[model samples]
Structures are given as structure tokens and as C-alpha cells.
Target: MPKFCFVADLHMFARRSNAERYQDQIIKTARESELCILGGDIFDFRWSKYLTEDETAHAAVEWLREFDSQTNHCQVHFLLGNHDDHPELLERLPFLEQEMKTFEWSRYYYRLGDSLFLHGDVADKTMSAACLKLQREQFAHGSRTELHNRLYDVAIKAQLHRLAPPAVYPCKRVAKRILNYMDNIGHGRETGIKHVYFGHTHRPMDHYLYQGIHFHNGGAPIGDAPFRILQRTVSLNDGENGLESRIRE
Candidate 1:
């Protein structure tokens, strides 16, 4: 049986302290698991707009490279999120591009014996209420960059409202609506997958036996909780049969 660690929404940025803590968590988890799966949003947008070649962004990149090297027993898989903009960054990294599997905003199906793992975001909507609130506050304060930032924020919020949550103010409400939609679609699909895991909502939830499917969300690694890891074990009987899934704090 092989064990895996699921982590998502690290949102690594210029904050040196945060980055150090995050690296520690990743290294620690990697040591204990067969593989580490990065759900998405590993880098924050702060470094994208600012920071040059000789800045902290490059240092952060180096940190990731070293972390990859340290985890000999585990392979890291990266699923792309909205925040990850530059493919070149990952491309330039050594030992990482080949070691990581990067997927777009789509479904990923991986089978370990009879169990399946999914970085669920295909049917997920966008932007939490917290994100929207921050945008509104910035706009109200008449911040210098408010106009440009608000434009993009409004566009995203509007799209999310149209697709998932009808209301744009409360992100939790929007997340719930999106989750319901995902559940419906997952149940309708015939993927032969017994367990599905995802992150994007930042809301930690565990629900099994929903229309004959098990659903799990790997919550945000930011916030009060540094990171959340989902652990699961699987076995094959006569070449195909047994699997076990568990979530670890």
C-alpha cells in the first residue's frame, strides 16, 4: 500500500516568514508520505505583479527546488490554479518540471488500486466573499490601484455569480452553491471512481455516500490552519480490489 499527502492553496508570496513555515510543512509531510500532491494556488499574485529577477521571487523559486530535491520518497504533483500565471517559472526550475505534473483548470483522475484522487475544481465557482469584501474595501478607500484591481475583481465576481453563486457578496454562499453543482455533476458521471478530492473553496468538508460517491476537500494551507493533508491507502486483491481513504490534520 502506498500513502499520499494532499496539500493545496499555499499562496506562497513575498512574506519570508510565511514561506519558511510553508516550506517546513511541505518538507515534513513529504518525508512521511509516498507522494505529495499540490492541489493548486501554490504562489500568490503579489510576486507576479512585483519582484524582479534578483528579488525574493527567485529565492522562493529556489526554495521550491530544494524542497523537491529533499523529498526523495515522494513525488510532487502540481495542479494549476487561477493564481499560477507563469508557466516559465516552473519550466525554468530544475528537477521540478519533470517531477511535477501540472494540470489546467480541469479534472484529474488518478487511480491507486480501487481508489481515485481528484483535485476537484472543474465545477467550482470563483472568489470567496472574503475576497470580494477586500476588493470592495479597496475600491471604497480610493486606493491608487483600486480602479484597475476592481475591474478585474468585478469581472471575476460577475462570472462566478452567473455560474455558481447568484449572490456576489458572501463567498461562503457562493462556495456552497458551487459545491452542490459539483456534486450533481460528479454523481452524473460514470468515472468508476470511488473517492474524489478537491480544493478551491478553502472550506474543509468531508461527505461520503453522496449519490454513491465519496467527496473530500483539501482545505486551504493558508489562514488559521497552515495546511491540510489527506492520507489514503489502497490495496489490490487478485490484481484489483481494496482501497482505504483517510484525512489527517
Candidate 2:
């Protein structure tokens, strides 16, 4: 059983003290776990909303060198979240240059064991109060490419190309809508996905079970919680554990 640390939505910015803290957390977590998975939004481009373009870029990549330099002992996997502009990130961050290997980025989602790891934006789009079910149904047959573009539209592209700052995620509405989505998506799909871990909700679910799928929302630093640590045998809270079985599984 491998140990993994799940953190998301750091929305890292240019403050010296903040950058230092982010680096410390990464290095420390890496040393303690088999791997550290930074789910998304590692860089906060939302600063562009208020800062000059150059300032935004500088602040976004301010601590990359030091952060990258200290990761020799721990393996880190980067997944581009809604806030991260993948192409721009590689160009701006020297450590993420094509030659860099110790730290790599996954354009799409990652898979490990029986779980599928994504940044959680896919389910985000259809989460509004109206047409939630209809939206998911409409996108049911859509390709991952299409879904990516749509999700990006809401998460980033629509907000003046600026990502959101840390906000209390998994708000009551988001949580309930997401749980409904988990029910509709059919947890045991071709990938045999019993669990899906995604960070981006900024809401630390700790554990949310719905429709046979174990949904873990890795909360961000938007509020009180810094991060959540997950081990192989961690037990999930069963608020509605049997609900999934009643549905299908």
C-alpha cells in the first residue's frame, strides 16, 4: 500500500512568506508520502485581474526555482487545474521547461490503482441549480476534449481569463449537486472507478459517498483547512453509504 498526500487549490501567489510556506509544505509532504499529487491551481493567474501583466507573471512564478530545487527526495506530480494555463506555465517556469523530468505535468487526469484522479472541473459545470441533470445528460456523450474546453470556460476563460482566488469550496449547493452528479455518472464505469479524488472544490470533503462512488474533495487553503492526508486504509464516513447500493452497485 502506497501513501499519498492529496492537496489542491493552493492558488500560489507572489508573496515571499506565502511562497516559502507553500514550498515547505510540498517538500515536507513529499518526504512523508510515497508521492505528492498537486491536484490543480498551483499558480494563481487571478492576480492578473489586478496586477500588470508582467507583475502577474512574475508573481506567479516567483518561487518556482527554490520550490523545484528542493524536491530531489520526494516525487511530485503536477496536474493542470482550472487556474493553470498549461502551455503558459511551461514557458514561464524554467523548472517546468521541456528538459525537466523530476517534476512533470499531466495535461489530463491521472489513474492509480482502482481510482481516477482528476482536478474536478468536469463535474463543476453541470452543478448549477437549474438544468443540473440536463447539463450532465447533454454532456454524457461528449468527448474529454469537448468537456475540457467547456469546463475551462467557466473555471477560467469566462472570468476574464483570470482564475478564482481561494474561496470556500464545496459550498452546500456544490456539495449537494456534486453528490447528485456522482449518482448519475455511474461510479463503476469501464475504468472500474470505485473512488475519485479531485481537488478544486476548495471544499474538504474528507469523505463523501454517493451512488457507489467515493468522492473525496481535497479542500484548498481558501479557509481554515490547509490540507488533508489520506492513507490506503482510511475509512470513509457513511452518511449515505447504502444509497449507492440502492441505486445500482
Kindly report which residue stretches of model 1 are placed more than 4 angstroms away from their true locations once superposed. Answer: 14-19, 46-61, 93-95, 98-118, 125-189, 225-227, 235-249
Overall lDDT per candidate, in order of appearance? 0.49, 0.52
**lDDT per residue, candidate 1, 121-222, as tens digits?**
443444343442233234221112446656645654565423432232233443344445434434322534455566655556565445455666655644
Best by TM-score: 2
Off by over 4 Å in 2: 14-23, 48-65, 90-97, 127-188, 223-226, 229-249
TM-score of 2: 0.59
Best model per lDDT: 2
TM-scores for the candidates: 0.58, 0.59
Q: Model 2, 1-249: lDDT tens per residue?
A: 467676667766512113334556667766777666777666665432324445555655554445555655355666666565434454565455444555555643555555555666655654432343244234322113445545644554354222342343434444455545444544334435556678766556655665555777755553233455444422223332222121100
